[model samples]
Target: MNEKIPQQSLKGCKPEIHYPCVWQYKVIGMERQAIQAALSKKLGDAPYSLSESRTSKQGKYISLNLELTVHNEEQRLHLYSALTADPSIKLVL
Candidate 1:
């Protein structure tokens, strides 16, 4: 027998986000240069700001805070997906 999982509704749970707004993404990676290279390859000449957020306790990883203006939800999501899919990027928040 197969069991069906209930789906949750987001009717009133999601926060309202205005389009063409600046969005911040925290990207974690093993190396800063690699992360920057990956971002550059993915984002091309798009305007963005990147800065060091924090370093891991052991100093094996680094997190970069990237801020960019997204035109819409699709653009935001697409960039998130691209960043997350990069080999150098370990996580995106």
Candidate 2:
């Protein structure tokens, strides 16, 4: 199911970003395998790095830091939206 999240309004001017830059995203989920699977499905054979960030106090949830190069704003936002919408992903930052 696709869930709609309330979009946050920008209060100030957006920051300038150079194109074809490396971007990092912190993804939280219940299982690492599911998260990896989701990422693999969406990102194909793209060169990226994934590292363990942290785990919940009870060790129930896991957060992974994902770093990848994005060619443009559209690619970055599209990946963010896709990851956030995935059931395996609890949150993305």
**Clashes (candidate 2):** 0
lDDT by residue (1-93, candidate 1, tens digit) is: 896645565445777899989999999999999999999999999999999999999999999999999999999999999999999999999
TM-score of the candidate numbered 2? 0.87
- Which runs in model 2 stand beyond 4 Å of their true positions? 1-10
lDDT, candidate 1, equals 0.94
Count of clashes, each model: 0, 0
Model 2 steric clash pairs: none
State the weakest 10-residue window (summed lDDT) of model 2: 4-13
Highest lDDT, which number?
2
TM-score of each: 0.86, 0.87
